[model samples]
Every structure is written in structure tokens, then in C-alpha cells.
Target: MFKYLKNDIPASIVVFFVALPLCLGIALASDAPPLSGLIAGIIGGIVVGFFSGSRLGVSGPAAGLAAIVAAAIGTLGSFELFLSAVVLAGAIQIFFGVIRMGIIGYFFPNSVIKGMLSGIGIIIILKQIPHFFGYDSEPEGADSFIEKSGETTLSALAHITDNITLGSMIIGIVGIVIILFWDNILSKKHAFFKILQGSLVAVVVGTILQVVFSSNEALKIESLHLVQVPAPEKLSNFIDYLSFPDFSQIFSKDVVLIAFTLALVASLETLLSVEATDKLDPEKNVTPTNRELFAQGFGNIASGLIGGLPITQVIVRSSANIQSNAKSKLSAIIHGFLLLISVLTIPMLLNHIPKSVLAAILILVGYKLAKPSLFKKMFSLGWTQFVPFIVTILVIVFKDLLWGISIGLVIGIIVILVKSYQNSMFMKISEIDAGKTTKLVLAEEVTFLNKATIQKELFNLHENSSLELDIRKTRYLDYDVVEIIEDFLIQARNKNIHVHLLSERGNVDNPESFIEFLKLDKIKTNETN
Candidate 1:
């Protein structure tokens, strides 16, 4: 990890800037003190980063959990109680890791995963727009389409003209230009530009702009439109900001329920981020998901102990780290240290930085995640992939992350069911002088899901048909499908249909009964095995 210090150090600086506001914003959205987010960022970076197997994934207070955290805090009656829940949640996540439940991430389809990344990217862009223009109506880290202020994302945009601040707009536009130029032109031309990432440059320039315009009334940006790091007057006063959990509430039923919910949701978010980060990794190194859970659990436990919001392996910071040219987990660790030092030593300097500059950095990050090329590529993969991918994006954009993903999973499962039903059996019908001959070919694996389709096909057969059932390709036949076939065979007699059963063991004419035939088939299959 130390081997890439030259790259890691600079990359860490970029991630630090990217993570700073996010930490505060998430805390604000969660209705927790801003300092709590910083603590989580610190722990997530230093603690989780050290334990995580992932070389690039960055952990911090997640916007995805903002609503849950807010609701939990309110429901629990106190922040201290909520902190207890967070600690328990971390313990539960560690249990999940111990039991190897990290494999849950692998269960999500590739299309859905891609959709998640793209959807998050779109959300980041939308959420950042108001900040970029100095419209600070909604909290910085709120991810839902519907804001607590009662403004929808589209409506927010529509009102942008009325709320735009001259200083913020100017700084934001210049910041964006600097980043774009650095990424597209300056970085290509010079090594210095590569080492000093565009995001940092944009931030520096925006800070300088803020100072230069501070004296001008109309052009000045407000304190609310800048980074808001809590600045304690003295070093000793910092301890006052640290919160401790109420251990007495550990046994409370509501606390336990909240803990379980946090554990389940945080674990899921971590796994998905692990997958996304690995995909984004230049070296394509696979992270150990179970280890990631362990790291996250530890981070959250540490975070909760100090009155912080729950931590997860966040995609926003991870992607920012990757795009900033992070080399290893060292970058993530270093960023945490930076967060610690910034809050302790130079918070006022941080406060000088414009929110619009950070918004510009995130806009670029968002663009990378939701590139138009990705949409076209998904479409080219056919509807099987495209439908879920698009639905996930749309739902996430219009709703929230979890709901979008849940709906996408439903759509993906439905698509699978449809395909399974269609492929369960292959039927070919031919007209013969006697009547009609129907040949039914069973798939390699027949499940209960195929029963309805098979029954419908059977019902559609001609009254005087001669039916040939082929089971040579079938490996495992479900009991429900077998029952369907049995019921069809019984009905065949009344329809004057003659049935011929074909298997690897050759043909049988008019099997005595479906149950007996299935038993014989099973015996043959076992013998062959």
C-alpha cells in the first residue's frame, strides 16, 4: 500500500475533499449533529479502510441510510439510543460476515448492479445541482427524489433560476471548467496535472474566488453555501462534540429491531458498493466480500461509540477515489486521517471552500457513473438486460435507491420467470393422415414454474392427437411438473390421444400411469448417475 504513496497521497486529498461535505450533509439529512458524520467518515476511513480487502472502496456515512437514521433517531427518543442501535447493528453485520453472508452481493444480477451505479450517478447530479447554483433548500446528502422541504428534483430545477446566487454560479461554472480542462487537456499535456487532480484544483480555485469576491455584496457567497465544518473555539472543546451511546438501552426491543434493520441495510449497501468498486478498479482485483463486511462492522461500531451516523462502503466516495487515481486502500486510510486533521486543525480553512466547487467535483463523478455510452451498451445487450437496467435507473431517479433496486429485482425475476416458462418445453406439431401429431421436448431442468405453461400447451392439443413426450434431455424433473404431465396423460384418454413416452431407456407405449412412469424414470436416472 505504501508503494503507491505518490499516487495515493494526492488521491487521498481529492477523496478527503469529496468526503468532507458528504459527511456533514449525510449527518444533516439524518437529523444528527454534523460532527457525527465527520466521526463516521474518520472511522470508516481509518478503521474500515485498514480491515477491508478492497484496495479502492471508500467507506463513510451513507446518504442511502439518511432517512432510516433520521427515523430511528426520532423513534428511539434520543441520539444516544440511536447510537446504541448503531453499535448493535455493527455487531450484527460482523455476525453476517462471520457466517459468510457476503455472498448475497453475488446474487444481484449484473444489469441491476450496473443500473445501481448509473442510478446513483444520476442522483448525485440531480442533488448537486441546487448546491451548484447556491440553492440550499435541501440538505446536501439527501438522496430521495422528494425532499424534506417538499420540492421534487424536477421542481427544484425549475426553481433554480429564482434562487441562483451570482457568486456561487460563477465559482461553480469556473470550477467545472477547471476540472474539465484538467481532465481532458492539462492532465494529458503535463505530469503535474496528473498528480494534482482536477477536483483539488477546482476546489482551490473556488476557494480563492470566494475570498476575492468576499467584499462585493452582490457577488459574495453566503456561509450557508460553503462547507460547514463545526469549529470548536478551543482544542479542549472538541471533546464536547463527541457523543456516547446509552448502553442501558441495549436490551430494549425497539433498539434491537432498529439495529437489525440497520445491519441488514448497511450490509446490503456495503456489498453492492464492493461489487461496484471492483468493477471500477483498473486492475480488476476482486475484493473479499466477507472481509468487507467485517471491516464495515468494525467501522460502524467505532462510529457509533463516538456518536456518528452508521458507516457503509459508500459508492460516491469510492468512485471519487477511483476517478482521482487512487492506488490502494492507503488512499482511503489517508483520507480518514485528513478528515481527522481537518476537523481538528483547519476547519475554518475548510469552511472557506465553496459548496459549489464540491458540487462541480461530484457532477463530474456523476457523469462518469451515468455516461450515455452505458445506456446504449445496456440497450444493445437486449431487453433481458436492458429492461431491468432502465427500470432501476428510472425508479431510482423518481423514487429512492432501495425502492428502485427492489423494483428492478422484481422485474429481473419476472423476466427470468417468463424465459423459464417459454423454454420449459419445446413443442412441434405436424398434421398426419390419422389426425395430428404433437412432439413435446422437456428442457434439461424442469421446475414447478414451468407447470402452468406445460398444462396450457397440453390443453391446446387436438382431440385426436398422437402425442410423443421426450424426456431424454431432462436431468431433474420437479414433482409439480411431473404432476402436470400425469394429469395431462389422464386427460389424453378422453381426448382419444395416444401417448408415446421416450427416454434414454428407449420408448414406452401408453404408460400405465403418470406416477408409475415417473417412478420408473427416476429409477433409470439414478441408475445412470
Candidate 2:
């Protein structure tokens, strides 16, 4: 872990800056104490990061769960009650890991995974646009298309123009310019430029601009547009921010239901981020998904015990860390320390940093994730892959993260079913002296999905036609398919169609029963599926 300290430290700083507004915003959105978000952020980075197998993933209070958290809190009648559910959720996640359910991440199609990354990227860029111009009505880290503010994601742009702050826009533009310049030019010039990342420099410039513009009424950024950390000057005062879970109701029916829901969603979000972050890593190391689940379980348990929102491996911070060129998990661990230290010692100074500077940094991260080249490449993969890929992006942009991915998964499944129906068998037809001659060869794997097509071809056979059924190449067969063939054999007798069954065991001029013949041949049957 110490092998890449140089790279890790610099990346940690950038991630810390990126995580600050997110922690505050998600907490506010969840209707909890602003500090709860930070607590989760700290635990996620320190505890989760310490145990996680992922080299680049950074965990925190995710925006994807804000609405659910808020609803859970409201339904449970108190924040303390919600904390109990969070604790229970952590236990459920641990159980999931014990059962090796983390393999769920591997089953997702590649197209859907890419779409998830690009969709999140597009969301980051669009959502930050309002903040870039200093319209901060919506809390930071709120990613849903429909916001608590009663405005849609795209509609929020309309208000930005009228509420735009010149100071914020100016600083935001400069921040973007500085980062781009430092990354593309100065960083290449010397190691000095590389150590002091462009994002840190932009934040410093943004803070100084806030102080410099204080004298001008039109230019000075208001407190609303700056970081809103709840600063505590003393250690004792900071302890007041912690909230403990009410464990009496931990086993209540409603609480257990909410816990299950949270566990399912949080695990899904974490696995998705793990997949996405690994892809973003230049080294392409595969994170152990089961270990990640176990790490997150402890992180949430710790957070809930001391008054914090639920946690998950977040793609945004992880992406920022990866883009900042973090070489190891040390970047994530140190960022947690930075959050703790900053909150304790310099929160007042941090509050002076304009949100616009952070917005600019995120915009760059978003652009990298949703680059136009990715679109062209996905399109080149053809419609079978592109349809679900594009659908995932649209739904994510219009709906939310889980909805988009789920719908994309459904689309992928449908495509597979259609392909199965069309390619279930190969047929050859010609006229013989006795009548029409039809030869049907089964596909490599026959499933219930292929039942309909097989039935249709058999039904279309002409009277007095001679039929040849070949399934020698089919390695796996479904019970539904066997039933369909059995029915066809019955129909053939009435239609006076001659039937021949060909298999590895040899040919039968007319097999009496499909099952008995297959049983004799010892063919594999996947009836359970």
C-alpha cells in the first residue's frame, strides 16, 4: 500500500474535495443532521476502504439512496429508528457475502455496465451545471431526475439563468481552464505541477476569489453557494453531532422490511460501482466483490451505531480517485482521515471554498466517463448491444440509477429470447416422391425458450410428409422442449407423417416416447431452469 504513497496522497486530496459537498448534500436530502453524511463518508473511506479488495473504489452516503433514506426515516417516525434499519441492513449484506452472492455483479452484460458508467457521467455533468452558475437550491449529491425541489433535472436549468452568480461562473470557468491546463500542459512540464494537482489549485483559487470578491455586492459568493460543513471548534462540541440507533425496534416487521430493501439496493449499487471503478482503473485489476460486500457491511454497521446515513461504494468519488491517478486504496483511506481532520480543525476555512470549483472538477470527471468516443464505439458494436446500451443511458438520465440498469437488463434478456426463438433450429425442406421431405436440426443448447419455435415448425409440416429430427449436437435439453416434441410425435401419427429421431445413440424410424429414448441415451436435461 505504501508503494504508491506519492500518487495516493495527491489523489486523496482531490477525492476529499470532491466528497465534501456530496456528504453534506446527501445528508440534507435524507433529512438527517448534516454531520451524519460526513460520518458515513469517514467510515466508508476508513472502515470500508480498509477491508475492501477494490484498489480504486471509494464508498460514502450515496445520492441514489437519499430518497429511500428520507422515506424510511419518515415512515419509521424518527432518525434513530432509521439508524436501526441501517444496522440491520448491514447484517443482511454480511449474510449476502457469506452466501457468495457477490457473484451477482459478474452476471450483468457488458453493454449495460458501460451504459451505467456513461449514464452516471452524464448525470454528474448536467446536475452540476446549475451549481456551476451558483444556483444551489438543490442539495449536492442529489442525482434523481425528479428532485425534492419539485423540479425535474432538466427543468432546473431554467432557474439557473435567472439566479446565476457572476462570481461563481467566473471562478468555475477558471477552475475548468486551470485543471485542463495543469493536466494537459504544466503537469507534463515538471513533477512539481503533478504533486499539486490542478483540482487543489482550482479550489485554492476559488476560495481566494471568494475573499477577494467580498467587498463587491454583485461578485461576492453567498454562504448558500459555498461549502456548508457544520463546523465545531472543540472536540466536545463535535461529539454532539453523533446520533445512536434505537435498537428496540430492530426486529419489528416494518424495520426488517426496510432493512431488506436497503440491503438489496445498497449491495446492488456497491457491486455496480465496483464494476465501473475497476474498468476505469488503468491497471484493470478485478476487485473481489464478496470482500467488498463484507467491508461495506462493517462500514454501515459502524456508521449506524453513531448516527450516520447508510453507505455504499459510490461511483462518483471512485471515478474522481481513479481519474486523479490513484495507484492504490491508500488514496481512499487517507481521504477519510482528511475528512475527519478537516471537520475537526479547518471546517471554517473549508466553508469558504466555493461549490463552483468542485462542480468544475466533477464536470471534467463526467466528460471523461461519457466521452463521445464511447458512444461511437458502442454504436459500432451493432443494434443487439447498442439498443440496451442506449436504453440504459436514457432511462438513467430520465429516471434513476437502479431503474435504468434494471430496464436495460430486461431489454438484454428480451434480445436473447428473440434470438433464441429465431435460431432454435435449422430446417431443410424438399419434395420427395412420397411427399414433402423436412429435415430439422436442433441447436447446440435447447431450452424452454426454444419450445415455441419448435412447436410452430412441427405444426407446419404437411400431411404425408417425411420428418427427420436431429438433436445429436444438442448438449442440454429442457423438459418443456421434450414435451413439445412428444406432442408433435402424437400429431404426426394422425397426419400420417413419417418420423425419424436421430441422436448419438443412433436413429429410430419412429420413437414412441421422447423421454424414454432420451433416458436410454443419457442426455442432460435442465428442467430446473
Q: Each prediction's TM-score against the native?
A: 0.81, 0.79
Model 1 stretches with alpha carbons more than 4 Å out: 1-37, 62-85, 110-123, 136-157, 188-192, 244-262, 276-286, 314-331, 366-401, 431-435, 493-496, 513-517, 523-529
Candidate 1 pairs with clashing backbones: none
**Model 2 per-residue lDDT tens digits across residues 1-529:** 9999999998999899778767865665566776788889999999998999999999999866765686578679998999999999999999999999997766778888778778867876776687688875654334445565576655566556766889999999999999999999998999667656687788888889988988999898998788776776677897776789999999999899888878877998899889888889899999999989999999999999999899999987998898788999999999999988877887788778787887787678678878999999999999889999999989977766567788999999998888888888999998779478899999988888888889999999988889988989887777788878878888888999888888888888845665588755534444333
Query: Whose TM-score is greatest here?
Result: 1
Clashing pairs in 2: none
Task: Write candidate 1's Cα lDDT for 403-456 as tens digits.
Answer: 777888999999999999889989999888958999999999888889888999
Worst 10 residues of 2 by lDDT: 520-529
Worst 10 residues of 1 by lDDT: 136-145
